[model samples]
Target: MSVEGNPGRRLLDEDRLFSSDPSQRSVARRLYAEIRDLPIVSPHGHTDPRWFADNEAFENPAKLFVTPDHYVFRMLYSQGIPLESLGVARRDGGPVESDPRKVWRLLAENYGLFRGTPSRLWLDHALSEVFGVQERLSAANADAVYDQVQACLDKPEYRPRALFDRFKIEVIATTESPLDPLESHARVRDSDWDGRVITAYRPDPVVDPEYEDFTANLEQLAEMTGETTSGWKGYLAALQQRRGFFAEMGATSTDHGHPSAATADLDPAACQSLLDRALSGAITAEDAELFRAQMLTEMARMSLEDGLVMQIHPGSFRSHNQKLMAGFGRDMGADIPTRTDYVRALRPLLSRFGNEPGLDVILFTLDETSYSRELAPLAGHYPILKLGPAWWFYDSPEGMLRYRRSVTETAGFYNTVGFNDDTRAFLSIPARHDVARRIDCAYLAELVCDHRLDEDEALEVAVDLTYNLVKKAYRL
Candidate 1:
């Protein structure tokens, strides 16, 4: 059968994610059309800079879609598929599936696992919009669809930098560790591509005492910055110098994925003692947390000096599965959300830097219960604090609506930065941002229907949520 004749080849309705109400759907359509084509400002994400640096065509469909994204594999893993069978490499250099076609077939056979999920929406959008593959992924058409996507990826226009232009992305940021040399970022900057790929500083490895090789990472930091990291003062100086280097490389923000939102403002001597214990590898779990908390405050202070926007996304119990961690290392979707307390936890840092007009601190949470009860009120009050959009598990359409309805009443629209894709999958970037735009429009339409906002005002807010807000919030 021809591709167009296949039932699965049909694309989604134009009003797919909008409200079902006739009046609200009409308003949502109007709002979506107005800002649907605006340039994407992806201020924070985990896409590899190596793709842009090398300007190489993505190798295959499975490598492009299935392997890199934990969203794809986690669902598959949940259904008893081994990560190794899905082309996820093991730590001991053990053999895994090497054939891209086989991986694609496995994903296609289990595509129904993603039904009614945000992953399904993203995958469908990437297939239909990015690769122009009309057929839905299934075991029956897996080979054909894989061939079609591979053909597109083989084309020059489908290359990473070219797709950046095609997706109408104005700027994109990739996260990097302080220990990284950022050679790929330097390559992109020196190249003539003009794609505007930037980096964000993620200082987790060196800051958290519980991190693997934490002491060794500090030694590397000292060597990189020529600062003595044996002492607390020199340790901070080394981090500050690295932040400066990141700024020179066009980094405008810093990210922290600590276990909790704890912050501390300890005196110099107390901080030194914690640092000494951390360096000696004798710190208790409580002291390790204290060290992380103190580092949050220190990172905030460094942001004040260097003007790097600070972002805190806490409450993840990272690498929750010991077996997964032992085999696949980290970020294989073993991270799970825990109950987070932001009210008392952030008070120390907020009280110290809350009044600083120059500082910028964006807060994200895995705990939805805190939206109106804690996050919104805090952002509404603190001069330096802003609420990041629904993140991680909450980046879905329903998640976006829940976020706006929950937080906007107290914090207002301006206190929240616009959407960030926050994805490692390159193709999912545009699809994720598109989801945010549709949901934001649906929300504004509901407001207009209720006489809460004028149509003209809704249009303005739509553009801000789509474009202006991210650029301003991230200082891009």
Candidate 2:
């Protein structure tokens, strides 16, 4: 399963993220050496499970690296590179680039657009480490690199299952709505190949009153789960039924991607009134937000009962680009992080379950200002809460460093789960995890150098941060 390195042509430096200081760099390298090869426990992600179920060869580099990945296209898009030219399919079946080589060339030609971004690090890692392209990608070598990756895609060892094993992923969870059939996950579970692919229940389609096809999604949920949606209780029962089904399909967690961390604990009558308005398509924006907030608390209650870890990643203003959304639909790299408030927003849910010994709630923030001020103090004191990794816009080297410095003094290492890539770019999974591990090693080295922590303690914390905590927190 080994691909020979390109030797001098590697895009990644051997000590890419280690400290620049000689003494601290040595310590970071020593700490990273032990846990760098640990099996990736991807307890949360957005990889397509069908890749493992069907075990098909990835079609091409453009499809794998560019089209589906918002991180890649968003930058290209920001530079005025039309998504259509990058082979992003239009919603109305409009003509886009049919040539994969053309799309890949756009990435290579505009490679400098990603120069200071994590996208650059990940793409280069995939190019040299995975495909052995040897040299930096450029317009000059675009087609040649495209051909090389296409050749690899056609090979047996580069198929999804083979690459999953090659990546050393112990288990990976793909997010799915409660209304999803999970046939892909079912196929992987029923298959003989034991690459542990699982699902996480993302109830946004059903819980978020503002979700597209809101009423229709409820109908589908009711029909699929054989529970009524005529009343608030029936809707809850239907969602609960779907959660049970997802658990049967090997789900260990439930994920909520709400717009904010707001939560509400309301009476049954109030819940029913909001449900009626939502179902009738007459819910006000305020009511819609309240409904979403209440649902988080309900989901937390369900998690306590079902033993599914709860993941709340709030503060994304989804589909920010109106024109792009109309033509290309959601997740076209248009989801922007908005200013978020967690302290008061999460009070309702935390007031109820914050001290529950059985409840495991991982809180994520798009708002970094809350790291030390709100999120760390919350996780530091609350038994139910744990800080998720530095996420979304801030998952880079500097971002990870900012997160550790902000939260560690208050929440400490145990109050935070290890890193989850949270990506649609499947090839970058290992690269993202590798970046987190390296940043952690570098951070731990600083602590050792300052004498705040002993070298031995830093090493143990590195392993915990790199691997163990994710498994424990996510129950993977």
Candidate 3:
């Protein structure tokens, strides 16, 4: 019998078909083959720009794969592996594992833990396709795979730009703080490399009062934009200035990672008073939230003015593991999904720009309950609104299917943006997109099988959902 840490064991057996029957699997496989090698269009993600800017060879398999990815670390953490052992950085300036080989061995020994998870699929694909590794990662093959991957890392063709080109990534967007100088992005542009790596303005550090060093961030914003961030008008202008700067760096979208979907549009005087209190550090937690809400509306208004796409991702109870958060800081995969209300919460911003034909506001949520109930209906009605794909915790095959099933009837295909891998794991980009394409084709195949749609139509819709829809939505 196959047990854990066996190199011969397959993570997914042939019996585990994505579709019910061999015929359906064959059909899905044909559909997947058509677009399997399509150039990746990563419109939004958390990939570090410095990687592309430097275009340096990756140090090792573990640092490239395990350390930076919360998905990998969180799973290890759940299995009682300390975050420090996983090389996760500590907030209290504590030490972490410096050896990449050790991290790789630890991750390899626990490979069985990712069974039945999307991580397994992604890892398997990377191992097979990227490293040419046929055997499963286990204690026996761990060092072998590590040495092979590390050897590849030392090669010139395995450098960041080389792999980016090899992966056929057409465009990748890296998220950046509004306070960022974008010097790395400038370096990328100046480089002879042709890879289109862009930046997206994430204004949370400056706009959200609860963010650490919020006051200092605002001061820096003022200095950067030459506007008085202490005043409402100047603050708004400073935000606009920074938005333009990001646009100059080829950013087409602005991302807001708010805690909730709450939005507001207070009058100028009221807004000014709120800004004053926030700037003075006199605002309560409630006021801070309200201010963030108003800023969402303000950001929409700015989006309309500048023609930048707006993405609002809300409803995460971030850093929920107080101990882990304290030890390893944010994005340790301790963020929990909560039930989010979009219809009522987004009313204030939608009321202002919902009917605007030119503006594009893409909405993403951690809450699945709101998909059909609120998000679909809202995106169905609003000219400016569109639904972002299943994100973060819900970016799985089931999650993708749920999104299509819940929202397709109301919002339909045109009202939704295409799949965004949204990963720090660079090698998983193609795998993630493949999963989405397969699930979409499978859904379309079901429609064909059920006689709800014809085979020819299903194929067309499959192509559109996988390729055309995302291009149109992201305006690429």
Candidate 4:
């Protein structure tokens, strides 16, 4: 492996995301300069906690970038690239590509598929900033780039914990199910390492009746907590027990990836019947949705009691490709966004807890239409609600600009939490945050250029967006 690259070629521009106008670009640069070195606050995400716990070297370039990131594989998959070639495992333990270099070559050969996409930005950022690979990835340079990144991964400084500190992460939260033992989080907590990696309770498997192995998951929960699942009260108690244990492991929040922002405040007898139907395998699609909806309210109530920030990102039609799901299982980038109605859907929960100052419910949406129309208005009015950053499908430069334009007028700055990478690609964390900070700076600069906001005030708001709001809203 060598640093041999195209002569005089640099992958990223110094002022990549700033305005083209001289004065506005100057303002953006000043704001970015003020907050560019701030510690990353990743409040909710899907990165595995075991990376920090085990403190092991990453496997290879392909596994590091291509295989685990849906953002990468999904774009390639859209261009008729079989996921098998990219090392996405089959559910029946069937064979797929095993050679990491081969996989990396495939991505490199088709690297143009990612051009003008956020995936390209993140990949290039990671390669250049993290590994010092200055050349752009291509079929010609794939082997060189692969070897270059692999050599970095072979070093102790590139280990997960070391990279955590090097990335200047103040604290990052990994999402976990109630059935999870939090062993990795426990290991991180008990180790001498000072890196802060905490867990967030994600109870989709136990709460959503239509989840895969739903009954079996509940049975496992009962086994873990010694509470029966046959009754609603006992099941709630078991969930509380798991939440308590997660809190003890340093969780500050609970995350929900429901299909919609639906909520219900059903009575005890109704809840008992719903539980019976759900457990007995007679749950209807509507009933399953209701059960999930009611659980959102219930989780909000529990959040008030235990002080965990509640998070919901609704409106993804997850696992949309049945064939892909059957072979590869869930979250293989088959998820598509669906229109979500928050005002009507959240009424049940909002009516009960909308006024509570103790509750903090952070809302995210795959549907950008909600940012101005639904989310901003709701967050602006509700004391307990806070808008999350542009998320999931919209974590790109253009998408982020759209989000700021849409939300700031109604929700303003304080009604929202700041940026979280929300990624499984560990290396992309810093790149993603860099994109956010730059985008926020660009947006603030635009406001200052238009005389809508003062330059000094915009600089202060930039710091809050990069650091302060995330800490306050997620209680991190």
RMSD of 3: 2.5
lDDT string, candidate 1, 1-476, tens digits:
54434555466668889999999999999999999999999999999999999999999999999999999999999999999999999999999999999999999999999999999999999998887667677889888888888888889999999999999999999999999999999999999989999999999999999999999999999999999998988999999999999999999999999999999999999999999999999999999999999999999999998899999999999999999999999999999999999999999998899899889999999999999999999999999999999999998988888999999999999999999988999999999999999999999999999999999999999999999988889998
The models' CA-based lDDT, in order, is 0.94, 0.92, 0.86, 0.93
Judged by lDDT relative to the true structure, which candidate is superior, 1 or 3?
Answer: 1
Per-residue C-alpha lDDT of model 2 across residues 1-476, encoded as one tens digit per residue: 12233555556788998888998999999999999999999999999888899999999889999999999999989989898999998999999998988898888898888888998889888887798866788888888788888999999999999999999999999999988899998888888998999999999989988989999999998889777896999999999988999999999999999999999999999999999999999999999999999999999999999999999999999999999999999999999888899999999999998889999999999899989999999999999999999999999999999999999999999999999999888899999999999999999999999889999999999999988899999887
TM-score against native, each model: 0.99, 0.98, 0.95, 0.99
Write one digit per residue (lDDT tens) for candidate 3, span 1-476: 22223576554443332588665676666666676677888999988889899988888898888988888888999989998887778888889988888899999999999987888888987887787677788887888889888888899998888988998889999999989999999999998988999999999999999887899998999999899998889999999999999999999999999999999989989988988887788999999999999999999999999989999999898899989877877888899988888888999998888899889999998999999999999989999998999998889888888999999999988898889998988888887887888888777767766777777777777777777877777777
The whole-model C-alpha lDDT of candidate 2 against the native structure comes to 0.92
Which candidate, 3 or 4, would have the higher TM-score against the true structure? 4
10 residues in a row with least lDDT, candidate 1: 1-10
Highest lDDT among the candidates is held by which one? 1
RMSD of each: 1.1, 2.1, 2.5, 1.2
Query: 3 or 4, which is superior by lDDT?
Result: 4
Q: Candidate 4: how large is its RMSD? A: 1.2
Global lDDT of model 1: 0.94
